[model samples]
Target: MFPRTLLLLLSLILFKTTHAQLHLDYYRNSCPDVESIVRSAVQEKFQQTFVTAPATLRLFFHDCLVRGCDASVLLASRNNRAEKDNPENLSLAGDGFDTVIKAKAAVDNVQECRNKVSCADILVMATRDVIALTGGPSYAVELGRLDGRVSTKASVRHQIPHPDFKLEKLEAMFATHGLTLVDLIALSGAHTIGFSHCSRFSKRLYNFKSKTRIDPTLNPAYARELRGMCPEEVDSRIAISMDQTTPQTFDNVYYKNLERGRGLFTSDQTLFTHKRSRDIVRLFAFNSTAFEIAFVDAITKLGRIGVKTGNQGEIRGDCTIVN
Candidate 1:
């Protein structure tokens, strides 16, 4: 048997080999203008609708969390058995899919770049562009992820965090993807610009626990405001901004809202209520620069999850259907 030290070294080498395949310039030779191409397409889409920003950003997170950023979330099975068909994913905005599809078309339009970039990479670039478009910090995105061939709805089960999740459940789910506590908190800040369906959080305002009809952590005024917007009998599809204060901008206001019991979801509020993460929440709430920096770093790491590189997957000509 190999010595313990040698075994440890070999494992480290293997880990690096797998992850090293992705980098800032992965398409430097194959698709030299890939980033700018995706950015332009995303910008055009953003101009058409503000939903492009939050939709695309949420798409990236859901795609990565479910299947390691493989763009499997983009695959559509005619039988309605694909990942996108999953109930948890059903709410993913059509705008997000459109953003990636538009960007993919733009990338392939350039003769030399045709089919040279992966749908996964286009999704990544578009996500970064949207964040920047919504007044969030912009950062370089590592590329080289390939589209996976498999996309079963069964794969999405238990992969997503529910709106009612507490800190423990949230941490456990994120940990499966190798995200740390700080990373989880930083990434959760993405809620700054998105909207959530009323059904997702109405329970917190109505029948939270046995002791109280409403969640005690929720600010009474905010609860009243939410009730006015989302009556118990209201349509489940009604949407509310995740960040009430600065709903259109991607910033540290998410943390601030949590501080004031204004978070729209139990999972969102848990970050500030849980002792382990509260200080980080306060730190971000008080410092936009620090929040921006942490957000960029955390999202960059998030983009690296379960990526298919080298010979593992394909660069599809069409994003929605496996080529």
Candidate 2:
């Protein structure tokens, strides 16, 4: 009887682990036009500023990586103790938060959908829409996430990958979230459209290893260009495109840039320099279709991280505050 009971328990656990309560049509009945509503809002924002694509994408990643995809990062605390207040998250663009807030407002404008959808789900749909708008794949997003009530600055520590992280550090961090090396490579492609503050990667161009002066991995010409754009005494807040080749397009050129030593971040170029991940980078660089497919699969899996369902969390009437 003990063995039988243990076996049954194990099977139940496995079932729960594999069957997360999220689906492409989760909001079909509660809010039939939820996806379109969020998509239209995102499109309007994207039209206003190209920053919408990368900022929203990065916000989704940061939110999911820290406390799952609960939208805790969206919460604002008057005492300035929320996750968004963390120094690591301070760089998150206001446009990202605005994108979700605007979409939430749009959803609530319709009587049937008012306060019916979770901010977490709105973020997921908005992320997909922005990606599609920026020439990335537009896959169906799995919904049904709920907004987390907790958003402490303490939770953001070491949760996000640093710009200078190497392949090993990156793999270990991603592994904790159930992401594979291929997933890491595929997701890094989001950098293809974003801009990074000079402080994030200036070390690569100015004081790599405190000895080489410049990171030897960077292409010489590219390094020179970066120096010109960000002089030694320039403001750290100066922005540089992550993918100089096609800053406005979300595509596999990020991998191609890695191959050419033009990657703006150490974490990015490491994907090509590290032997274990180099092959995957080469594959993505040469095959745009493979990159897109892997990205879609990876992001879908990412959306499943630490999700709340079945009364685990609440749907907030205001995305920036708990209901």
- Global lDDT of each candidate: 0.88, 0.90
lDDT of 1 by residue, 18-55 (tens): 25768888889888988998899999999999999999
In TM-score terms, candidate 1 sits at 0.93
Runs of candidate 2 exceeding 4 Å displacement: 1-19, 210-212
State the displacement of the C-alpha of residue 28, model 1, in Å, after optimal TM-score superposition.
1.5
Writing each residue's lDDT as its tens digit, candidate 2 over 235-269 gives 99998999988999999999999999999999999
TM-score of 2: 0.93
lDDT (Cα, 0-100) at 289 in candidate 1: 76
